[model samples]
Every structure is written in C-alpha cells, then in structure tokens.
Target: MPSHPSPPARSAVVVPYAPDAPPPQLAPLAGPDRPGGPAVPERWNAVDRSAHAPHLVAVPGADATEWIAAALVTARPGTSYLKIVDALGDVPAAVGAVLETARRRGLAQVKWEGWTTTAEEATALGFTPLRTPPGAEGPDSGYIRRLYGAEPAAPPYYAQTTHFTCGAVTALVARAHAGALPGEALDRDAELTLWRAATNFPACEPVGLGVAVHRAWPSAPVTVFLDTEDPVLLDHLPEAEQEWRAALQRLSRADAERSGTPVDPRRLSLPEIRAALDRGGHVLLLVSLATLQGFDVPHWILCHGTVPGAVVVDDPWAHAPAGDTWVDAHLLPVPDASLDAMSVLSPARFRGAVHIAPASTGP
Candidate 1:
C-alpha cells in the first residue's frame, strides 16, 4: 500500500471572537464541541481591548489537525498590539507568519505587550527591544517591532490610576494630545485633580467634563452633546443621592451655558465624530464598558481619529485580567457599529460626547 500523503501547511486565519459572548456571525457554532471549533483559552478571549483585536490568529500544523501557534491581536489605526493572554506552541517562530497576516490586514506594525514573554525572546524573533528607561512609554514589560518604517503618530498612553477616574483621565489625555498639557505631566495627581473638578461623585458626565475642560484651557473650543436633560451618571446611586446629583447636572448645564460652551441636546453620530477628528478636534465619548470589559458601568474614552472604516480611541482603563498595557489602550481602532452600540447607555438609552477644538498645536 502507498504511504498516506502529508497535509499541506495551513496559513494563519483571523477568527472573530468575543470574551463575553459570541458575535452574531458565528451564531450556530457553539463551543469547542463543534467540528474544527476554535481552541481559544479564556485568557486570550479579548472582549473589548479597543476595537481591532481580541481576534484569533490561528496557525495549524501541516496535518491541519493541531494548532502550531496562536495569539490574540488587538488592532490599532496602523498597528496591532498583542495581549499577554494566550500564546500556544512555537509562538516565537510564528512571528514571521503573524507579521505576514498583519500585513495582509493593512497593518504597518506589530508589538507584543509583554506578560511573561522576555526581551531576549522577542528580540530573537527580529523584534526591536522596547525596554524604555525608568519613566518612559516604551514597554517595560515586553517588546515591539515596526513592520513598515514609521506608523501614524498616536497620542501617548496614560493609564487611569483609580477605578473612578476614567472620565477625568480621558479629558486630560485629550488635553495632552492637543498640546495643552505635557505627556509627562499626566500623573495620578493630575488625574485626581481633574477628577475632583469633573466627577459627579463616582462618574463624570459630558457636560460637567466639558465645563472643566474650558476652565482648564479657555482657548480650547468645548462642545457637549447629550440627548437628555435628565440627571445621568446617577442611576447607580441611591434615589436621594440621585436627586442631588441630578441637581448638580442641571447646575453643570447652566454653568456650561453661562460660559458660552456649545451644548447640543442630541447624540453625536459616528460620521459627525469622524468629521470632528478631521477638523483636528478631540472628542470625549461616554460609553458602556460592558461590550469590551464585561463591566456594565458607564465609562468615558477619547476619540482621537479615524481609519478606513474604524474610529480611533484611547481607553484609559486597561483590562488587567487580559494582561493588557498601554499598547492595548492607545490608538485603538474600533469599528463604527461597535462604538455606536457602546455609546448608547442602557436604562437611559442616551448618548453623550464632548468635542474640544485644537487648543494648542505646540508641544
């Protein structure tokens, strides 16, 4: 009898996945029980690490029966950042193949947000060392590589120090991007200072945040979009507290009007947002963390720019469980549909956005 022929080597494929729930496209295919089903570990299951990623890059063996290597890549405007969540079998050797896959997807760079992976291991795979000095933005954890010469300049990443400071941090980051503040000035102290000025106790409302922005930088044109006049960011508080907070929101709105800030009582659509970015404006969008982080809490993120069919954002909070770093949060490329869905808060069914004109162009 003739010997059985070897199976051809299989190329890597990007598979749609969500850590919290399966997307509609994969409706019928249940779990690993399905034929040729995915073998994604819970750790690599990226739900919302900023739009472009959490998708699987699976390379199969020549026999096409077992995985040769796999990883989760979060897409950015022109780059892809890998989370430390999962890497199976010969990951280092698979770098070239991964880069090829990324190239086909229009990516210009590939970087590994180090979890347990080392610099030597990354450098061995032709990746440049990302070990930044004591207090820089380079990967203190892992390494990175630029496939193409240079990539689109993305705003620097600044992680929120405390859980309740996302909105304040987001606004401050927008200021930094606009050259109103320095990247090095973004610290826990600055974070709390902005938080104190903007927070509605636990959360930051768009109107209030916009008011704070004008106070900090009067030159920056501030425009706020909110669909409701009712008190928001207070649904989770006690009824009595909700009333006071609601009063505060009304006061914030009045203050905004008095300060000559633009307040539009409607949601800012994706197209409108993209247009703002094109005009050199940074938008602070309030979103629900549920779609990406599994938390149903209201969150705030900065919309910096747009790519092909995606809007770029910088989410302050990194999902630590997935071992994410600044690489995952900075310049995240979220599709239009996802941002629209996440921007509409439940119970309230309202949307909130704050637009800031180019306050300063000088760093």
Candidate 2:
C-alpha cells in the first residue's frame, strides 16, 4: 500500500445512519466542499454532499457498548472496493461491521484505508498493509486492510490520461504484469503509443487491441472474444465516421489473423474469464461504465484475480474530482453475475474481452 495523501482534515462530526447492517457508501470523512467540479485534483467534493453532511459514521458495536466513528472512504456499489478511510475505536469492530455490511450487500470487496487507527489494533482486526505493491507496513503510516479473501497482487495503477484510452492502458497494464513491458515505462507515451496502435481512430475495438498486445510480445498469447463480426464501438458515431471506423475494425481483424491472435466469435462468459485468471492469465475486459460508473459508455478494464463469487479488475479511469484514486481502481472485486451483465459494450448487448496468458513453454 503506497502512502496516498492523507484524507482531508477530520472533524468529530458523525452522521446518523443505519447502525446495524447497511451503511451509505458516500459518507466521506472530509470534503467540507461538495460537488468537486470535474477532474479537479485533491478535491473530495464528488462524494461529499451538502454543507453539513457529516463525513464520519457512527456504527454501534455488536454488543452495543460503544459507538465507533468511521470515515467511509470509497462508496461504490457492487463492483467497487468499498473503503473505510478510518475509524476511531478501541476495537476494529466498528469499521469491521461496516465491511461486513458492504459484503452482505454484495459489494465485491472492502478496504480499511487507515487514517487514524493504530497498527496494533489494525493488524489485530485482520487489516494489513499491502506487500505486493509494497504496503511498507508498520503503524507509522496508513496501512490498508483488504477484506474478502481475494489476493492482494495488483499491477501498478496507471490513470488514463485521455478519456478514450482505457483499452490501451488496460492492455499495457497486462503487458507490464506479464513481464512484456517494464512497469516503470507505463507512462503517457506508452499509453498513447499503444492506443495509436490499437485504436480504431479513437475507440479501441477488441481485435485491434488484441493485435497490439500480441505484436508487442508474441509469446504472451493474446486471444480476443467478441460476439459480432460487424464493426463495434461505432454505434454512436455518424454515417461517415461509422464507415471509416468499421473499415479499421475489419483491418484489425485481418491483423489479428495474420498475427495468429485468435478472435473467438462467442461471447466470453464470466466463468471463462475466471478460468483464464485461474490459469494465471490477465484479461482486458470490455464493459459499459453505466453499471460501474454513472456514465454509459464503452470502457476497458484489466481482470487479474478472482474471489469466491467474483473476479477482480484494475480499472484505469481514475476520476480525481470524484474523490477516486488508484486505491479505488486497483484490483477491486466484481461479482460473477453482475460482471456478466456489465461487460456488454453496445445496444446489441454483445460483450468483448481479451485474454493474455503467460508465455507458452515446451516445444
């Protein structure tokens, strides 16, 4: 867990909410200023609401002996890593209860993004600093406790500099994780370069992105799954724009064929996505941001791990103004059934995905 900037200044103000099972995901600890505008930096207004909205939540302990004040860090629905920024309590039960409530409601996973809690009490509550990404453990700083038994391994987070390059960024992250590209080299240049290689002008068609990854490292074994042969990701474009983009997609399909990148016509089911990951593969999943985010548009995310009934994905579009950070994007859980429905890319309801596996061995 790399040290993120500490959450905004905390006041003891606690908002009243359901103390027992369910809790509102948005009630952030700080951001006295709500509405955050667009893409602003260091502003927590996106999640904050109203001038008097209390950032802290008081969850009564199981025994009802004490009321624990917790800062609900990331308030996302089923497909997010719900985070509780911090909680003031002798025991972790207060925040722990929040986590349990989130899980019961089918949030993919949860994190205790510490702000005020001490290491002794945090570790005692099954909260731990992340090591794969270098949690840099100890009480001296904010250590996260990821709830749910999902693995902590995450490809380093890379925020998409441009709005439409999520597919490119996602493929690059897969390349970095599979040792095809230096993780440190995943900068703006790399992002645009890959997008230029893979994009059908701007939107990343599945075949084009797959071809780019396979071309970057042939041994990485890229396979794309798209249900339709007709040009996709061009529905919103006008007639002439759709014509050119559709041509580019056909060319991409040709490229994939030449590069030996298999393009399966069948839709990649959620179980297949999980199976690829279980075999130690990374997936660039095409999804509509409507269910995950408020907007309805085609987006790409990297699927790297799986929990009990869900698959974990690392999304690249980190909206800073929305009070979203890499912590929000990094390896969050998405339930199996929900992921199936969210992965669709068009009005046609066909979904897309690219599976990249480790280099094959044995002649």
Candidate 3:
C-alpha cells in the first residue's frame, strides 16, 4: 500500500493575540456544544480556543519546541509542540529536558528567551541554525519571530512536504510486511483505521483501549507470476500454513480445556488466528521457523496485494501448560527431561521449536 503523506511542518503557528483574545474556534471535533458532542475537536481547533490559546505555547513543555520544530522542517506538523504540551499537562521540567536533549543532539535551538542560543553557539552545539529574515511580520510571522528572530516568514509550510525521511519510511514499511500487521499500514493511517473500525468513531476521537500488533517476521518480497494469465503478487508468509495450523490446534486445545468448550482447530481461519495473537495482556507464544524451507513456511512471501517484500506471522500461543490432554500436533511437545534446559524464544522470533526456561534451572 502507498504510504501516508508526511504530516505537514509547522504543526502549530504562534499567532499573536492580545491576552483578551477571543477564544479561537474549537476544531468541530472539540466543541461540547457542537454536533460532534463532547468529543474534543481536531487539535488545531483546540489550540485556537484553549485557555492558553494566545500565548506562544510549545506543545506544553519546553522540550516540545525543538522536536516540534524539527518535525515541522521534516513535514510532520500534524501535532505541534504546544498542542502536545497541552495534552501532556504543560510540565515545564519535562519539556525543558526535551529541549536540552535536542540542543545536545544538535537537533534544534531556542531563540528570543534567555535560554536562546546564537548562530555560533548553535553551530558549536552541532545545529545548522536556521533563522527568519529580519523584521518580518504577520499572524504567522509571529511564530517565526519567537523561533529564529523577527525576519523573513519561516519556510513555507509546504517546504517540509518531502517523502517521509528514509529512516521513518523504512521502519514503518518493515513493520507492515511482517505479518505483525494485517498488512503494512502506516502508523498514522493504521491507528486511524483501528480507532474507526473498532469504535465506529473518527480517528481523532479517543478510544478507551489501545491495541497494537507486531508481526514476528520480516516482510517478504512480492513476486509477480507472469507465467499465469493473471499476475498475482505472490508474497511469502513467514510461517508455513501448517505451522499456523499447529499453532491454532495448540491454542484451541488449551482454550477448550480452560473454558470447558470445544473449539475445533480446523475451523479457525488465518485472520481469526492472527486477531487472537494480537490481543493485549496475554502472555504471547511465538514459534520461529527461521530456517524452515519454502513449502513448509517460506521465510518470505507476497503480502496483501501490495508491497514487494512483506513478512508474515500467524497465530501465536502461550507456553503455559493447559493440561496433559491439551498437547496438540501444532507444537513440538517439550520433553519433561529437557524442560529444565528450555528457553522461550523472543516474541519476534516465535517460529522456532523452543521451550520456556524454568526459573529454577541454573546455567
């Protein structure tokens, strides 16, 4: 799937308003009186109407300004520094720490306040040190003044609209192809989709519970088979279909014993099994078929219609024994004698034949 557009830079602008400035209109999502009901509207709207609205607030803390600025220049202005500050309770100490860290990392610098740094100071600290033209003025210009100085309007918002930085995109896509995700969904889009699908609410709206998934495999490279009349993007799933079956059988048998209900392992589909593994709170079971051959569960495969390389992981299980009868063909039952020599594989590498290490066992 195509990646989501990078959030624009300049997430929030510091528009100067008098202390008595009228409440900026809330984003329709935020207004209690609005049709959306009590839900807080889009953050930008909230920023306009917030009690600290007119003040030049960085996302709540001092730390926000630097990261926020960095994000702005990089084209992710969706959530500005001050907006984050409000959400995080505007803690000065925490925010200040973020700023200090940014400076040390040469990511950003402060201007205007006593805490501000000069170009030379910024360069020494490893920053490129951007500044605005002298004497620039406007509602938006106020934001620039507070950062670099009274000068040219900060770079136009669109200037930041380049493709997601290489690091960000690579990481996001890698996660997506790895069966950890239904498919590789960009963070912003995936979260929004989950919020909407799970609650029938908009992405910006709040949900009581947060759910996440991590496919334990690498995204397989997608291959198109022109040999057939139809070009199917054949992507490999990490675990063989049989391994998935084994996992499900193991899980179903355990669940049956625990709930005193019979659940046929054969009936569970791939998606259902994946959903179960993705649930929060459970001690996840992972089996790593790392060196497994192609027919058994190739290490790579095509993903849901897109992405040349997508990793795939299927249902996971817990290592805890349900009962003697719960043993199923899906897993290699641990030998009682070797139980003391076992170690649970990392969740990301759950495809191997391994056993949980008993705490009583010594090296």
Q: Which 10 consecutive residues of model 3 have the lowest summed lDDT?
A: 202-211
Q: In candidate 1, where is summed lDDT lowest over 10 consecutive residues? A: 1-10
TM-score, one value per model:
0.73, 0.77, 0.18
lDDT per residue for candidate 1 within 186-250, as digits (tens), equals: 88889899888887887888899888888888888888999998888787788988898888888
* Candidate 3 Cα deviation (angstroms), residue 206: 10
List model 2 lDDT by residue over 38-109, tens digit each.
Answer: 222122333432212224445554545444444444444446455654454423445655555555566655
Instruction: Write down the TM-score for model 3.
Output: 0.18
Model 3 regions more than 4 Å off: 1-50, 53-193, 196-363
Error of 3 at 339 (Å): 43
* Candidate number achieving the greatest lDDT relative to the actual structure: 1
- Model 1 Cα displacement at 308 (Å)? 0.8
The residue ranges of model 1 lying beyond 4 angstroms of the native Cα positions read 1-10, 13-93, 99-111, 115-151, 360-363
RMSD (CA, Å), each prediction: 9.4, 7.6, 22.2
| Sequence-dependent TM-score of model 1 | 0.73
